[model samples]
Target: MIMRPPGKSARALLAATLLAPALATAQDAQGQNVTLELNAVEQVDEACRISFLIQNGHDTDIAQAVYEAVLFDTEGRVDRMTLFDFGALPAARPRVRQFVVPGMACTALGRLLINGADTCTGDGVAPDACVRDLTLRSRAEGVEVMG
Candidate 1:
């Protein structure tokens, strides 16, 4: 049997199929926002270990991402304020970072507030890129996360 060229509709379909992924990737890079989720909190030794799952959806990798965080006690009083340094977050990737607060217990915490991004530096990244369109989430029970 001799092979023949594909018809117009078939060619169009093939082209669309080939370009769909690239188009979707472009759209995703343009519309995606950084997501930070409070993944877990547990007691480790005499300290409280807090975990964060952060997804970098931008097109550039983050060399250093630091956020000012405030921890509140169960009575709504400010327990502590510190900076969480999530180093080297690649684009379109999710990273988990853990911090241990000495002499603190997980059960004593009521809420974690992300005050702002102290530093978000990377190639092709804006000064406020990390916090401008950030989406916050929490999966830890008995603790609330807020921007």
Candidate 2:
């Protein structure tokens, strides 16, 4: 917790208060803009791994990212898949997050989440039929704290 000097809070609050007009101005950019769209599965492997993609929505300059997940049925199974959330930290190298599916190592989904640097979800796919959601996480800037 940050401790403030006595009476300093009042002065800070008075000086930093935002006006109604200012709030409206800051929120003026709100809109239902399409940031990205999921593409089809490019390939799958013997390990049941899956690969998928998403296309950046209509603008090359907008470097957004995609987030995705997968589901299975009665006969379906997965072991683990590593995802690279490229959109999480634009300048950072790709991440490889491994999730152990509800199955054996012999049949893990060969496909995993591939975060895009906007518009480039990579030319990849899985080799089998599985329910995987290709979702996107958008941002105007890389505003994340470093560990």
Candidate 3:
């Protein structure tokens, strides 16, 4: 029966616990999943005015924000980004930031203005009863260019 001193064992356990989080972060960074994030953004004048803040989607990920306003000239298609200042995300907390990135054209972004908390409104007990309205903002003033 080789019993270690209780104090020593407790210190070792505490040290492990403290280092666990950092080790976990390193593991996640080495993962293969390339996660992209669009926290939040304010569109000024529907075009020509967009501040950008981008992250790699990890809790402490760092990334550069780049959004060339020229992704809509191709066949009038435009890619859009949504904003959710309120409400949390699935399996994570809600994060908000401003960003502009070269997007795929002809995209529609929806922001639940009023009912952003639930974001679930298939409340139709019958075939179709509940109806919700989302602010669908289409990409505007983007040229046919991508980078």
Output the number of the lDDT-best candidate. Answer: 1
When 2 and 3 are scored with lDDT, the better candidate is 3
State the weakest 10-residue window (summed lDDT) of model 1: 25-34
Compute the lDDT of residue 80 as modeled in candidate 3.
41
Instruction: Please estimate how well model 3 matches the true structure, expressed as its whole-model Cα lDDT.
Output: 0.32
The regions of model 3 sitting more than 4 angstroms off are: 1-26, 29-34, 46-53, 56-76, 79-147
- Each prediction's TM-score versus the true structure: 0.82, 0.24, 0.26
Predicted structure 1: lDDT: 0.92
The pairs that clash in candidate 1 are none
Residue-level lDDT tens digits of model 2 in 113-132: 33222222322322110112
Worst 10 residues of 3 by lDDT: 126-135
What C-alpha lDDT values do all the predictions have? 0.92, 0.30, 0.32
Residue 58, model 3: lDDT of: 27
Off by over 4 Å in 2: 1-46, 60-64, 74-147
Candidate 3 residue lDDT tens string, 21-122: 998887565442112232233444443223222222222222222222222323444334344232222222223444343332123332212212223211
Any idea how many clashes model 1 has?
A: 0
lDDT of 2 at 111: 28
